[model samples]
Target: MKAGTNLEKILESGKFAVTAEAGPPKGTSAAVIQRKAEMLRHCCDAVNITDNQTAIVRMSSLAGCVIARQAGVEPVMQMVVRDRNRLALQADILGAIALGVGNFLCLSGDHQKFGNHPQAKGVFDIDSIQLIQMMKQMRDEKKFLNGDEISGDVPMYIGAAANPFADPFEYRVKRLAKKVKAGVDFIQTQAVYDVPRFARYMKMACDMGLDKKVHVLAGVIPIRSLGMARYMRDYVSGVTVPDEIITRLEKAEKAKEEGVKIILDIIEQLKEIPGVHGIHIMAVGWEDIVQEMVEKAGLMPRPVL
Candidate 1:
């Protein structure tokens, strides 16, 4: 049942798992993806191939996974419910697994208004929770949504996203529990800039013992520059960038190294938390710095998967 994914094997061996994310190019260039994956190789246990994140069009996540795999990086394929109907979603799942993708992260996706196509209609055919359950059925029961048996096997490691800093913050842990009950094997949360808030969220999850049942990987995005920090603070919701971080970014002579240091400090503290199983570094367009950050955090040359 282990999907033969390095990530699954790393976590199964009880090592602190590290993962990164990469967006496939908007054009048909798998080479671009392969190059990025090569940069992240040996930097983390696996790389998450993002689906048209922010609703901007790009190569499919399935194709991105193929490129990453060919580059020798394990991938967690992201699936969003915003554009695909039930049939398309299931079809992609089948197709992705057939093409050797073994891990997935189910998402409700950002609304289309945020991307290039503001006029595109949204598809909420099924929410993310339902998608999680559907995949669980396919993998565990070896059946599709219509209850038809799969020809050979349905092997997948399912994950869900959570935002601890989002509104109704008091209920974030409960929402995570819902995902766990619905069959999430692992979870990757939104960016963590507030140590107190993240600790609170982990405390709650630990209280319920959800941490023991599922892997919880905290998300961290290195602040590339003072402007980037300000941009995220002003535009991104559910993300908290402390004024201290902003001040540090503003004062640093070398912004990128300072950013890496800040994130390294965070990773050091995050690893000590009881429930946090790993770190998922979202390098965004700054993929070049991921391995350095991981290395500084003492997670370098990643554990074998």
Candidate 2:
């Protein structure tokens, strides 16, 4: 069992794994992270503690992971290349491992221009693909990116993000292929609102046998209101919310309930796709809704492996 994390165990055991996102608070309040972690504890195998997501500075993901562990939930620590150089990245990986963080998600973070600190310069020392390769080497060979030997085991269940809903659709699969080749053990894609398009992406991935090489978890975000839906459809990069969803929410008496129904329907449809190993719910600020969504989707009673 690679890393022996609950996420890896659930996926390796062939169960439809469920993972969720938990954004850290901007301040030093551990209570906020603890509350979010408690809310998500039983709903998902693990929660992703985001690292300065959207280029907005926040509590460190490593600290959040430790707090989430205190809340009795496993955490998938997210590391972005935008904020740190290779030395910092490698050092943080070692630090997180020493703190018992076994799972990681590598990402090229959002641009600093969009964040609270617009003047901040991005380090982008290495992109997400190289980060994956580096983590894999650290885990499998006990070696650093510079090929120096490590004294002890660096066991990590490496993961990376994918955007199947992104433009130039044909290239999405190829990009995922590169990550798999880079030795990522799992993938969590961009939020999926256009099911047909996502299915096509999966078909292409399956044709290349990418599913067999790595666990692919289709991402879904629960739409809360018409404004949110429209914003995601028009503004969010790589996310494609369908017009039908917007129309439904537009006319619904209770948009929130309708939104929940939409997410459940997407879950049902995603389960039917061939290469999908699981679902990753990104509720954004609505972390409290994850338990209900997971339960209503019949993904509850998370495996004991």
Candidate 3:
């Protein structure tokens, strides 16, 4: 098999790219991970293995990426810098690259207080932007942190996250622009329930002429129930649920069916937005519904490269 970077190709082609995340199991069972990867293999351009997502300890992101790679699926190794210092971050990136994982998503990670280990110390040794710069330096300049020249480069297609719905939306766009300027190859935004609001953000990016410079994948998470909708609206920072959507969920006879319908509607609207490079589905625990949503959205599985 030829070595290929699907995420890189998708960005280069300027087409909408589709990515899905697969959470690792708490135990050592590869069955769950493999099943999730296999289910999304034909639908997603790449599978992102989240690193201790939500600060909850689970299987290692690196291990999950290796399994996905062995299963003939492209893996996006997510690196959270919160739990690890610069040394660990660099070491993990090198290890993942050595294991045939070329795509990465840099994150500052969830706070330790949000996890089971609330007493654990938090380490924000390097922010996501600095991490991206570091990776670029390692890959392009073949230089290490200590100013030592490395023999070989760690070829990687780097990605970062943005939350347009966060407080003071203008600041979010500005922050994302900084990440792009720092050499982030691609970005996956927070779940955007408000299409009009997201369109405004896209317009801002276009006005700044940053839209053409990097690939932006709008994140979408399907709402399973009215209760879930309420939770998201109340708790999830940077996520907004429209009153109409909530009412629709409240009136629906079946919440799951309604949730799928809502996501389908979102995809329909999102597809027409200019500067939208792709959609990233965060169907947390609802991976089985991804194919239906993808087909409903009329997206085909185009190889990234």
Candidate No. with top lDDT: 2
Pick by lDDT: 1 or 3, better one: 1
Off by over 4 Å in 3: 1-4, 303-305
Write down the RMSD of all candidates, one decimal each: 1.0, 0.7, 1.9
Candidate 1 per-residue lDDT over residues 108-141, each given as its tens digit: 9999999989899888899999999999999989
Per-residue lDDT tens digits of candidate 3, residues 19-124?
8989988889888889998888888889899898899999999999999888767899899988899889888888888899999999998888898899989899
**What stretches of model 2 exceed 4 Å from their correct place?**
none
Model 1 local distance difference test score:
0.90
Rank the candidate models, highest lDDT first.
Answer: 2, 1, 3
lDDT (0 to 1) per candidate: 0.90, 0.93, 0.86
Encode model 2's per-residue lDDT on 191-243: one tens digit a residue: 98889999999999999999899999999898888899999988988788888
